[model samples]
Target: MSEVKNRIAVLRAEHKISQQALADAISVSRKTISTIETGRFTPSVTIALKLAIFFNVTVEEIFSLN
Candidate 1:
């Protein structure tokens, strides 16, 4: 299977939002956001959509298959 890559850290930095802050906004744990940013976890579709909506970007913009 192809690996999923993400630009979450970059986006978060650009938005000046901490991992915990983003996690709170999305109703997820900070570790969940951390793992996703570190490529240790892949978020569910619901989480992905929540993130995309919060960041004002599409899911494809945050994550991609590589």
Candidate 2:
């Protein structure tokens, strides 16, 4: 399977928010956000949508198949 690539860290930095803050905003755990950012976890569609909504961007803008 192709690996998933993401710009989550970049987006977080650009938005000046920590993983914990983002997780709280999205109603997820900080560890979940951290795992996703580190590429150790691939978020579900629901989580992806939540992240996109939180960032005011598209899921495609945050994640891609590499």
Q: All predictions: root-mean-square deviation over Cα?
A: 0.6, 0.5
The lDDT values for all models are: 0.95, 0.96
Candidate 1, residues 1-66: lDDT per residue as tens digits? 899999999999999999999999999999999999988999999999999999999999999999
- Candidate number of the best TM-score: 2
Cα shift from native, residue 54, model 2 (Å): 0.6
User: Candidate 2: misplaced stretches above 4 Å?
Assistant: none
**Per-model TM values vs. the true structure:** 0.96, 0.97
List the lowest-lDDT window of 10 residues for candidate 2.
1-10
lDDT of 2 at 59: 99
Q: Which pairs of residues clash in candidate 1, taking residues 3 or more apart in a chain or in different chains?
A: none
lDDT of 2 by residue, 1-66 (tens): 999999999999999999999999999999999999999999999999999999999999999999
Which segments of model 1 are wrong by more than 4 Å? Answer: none
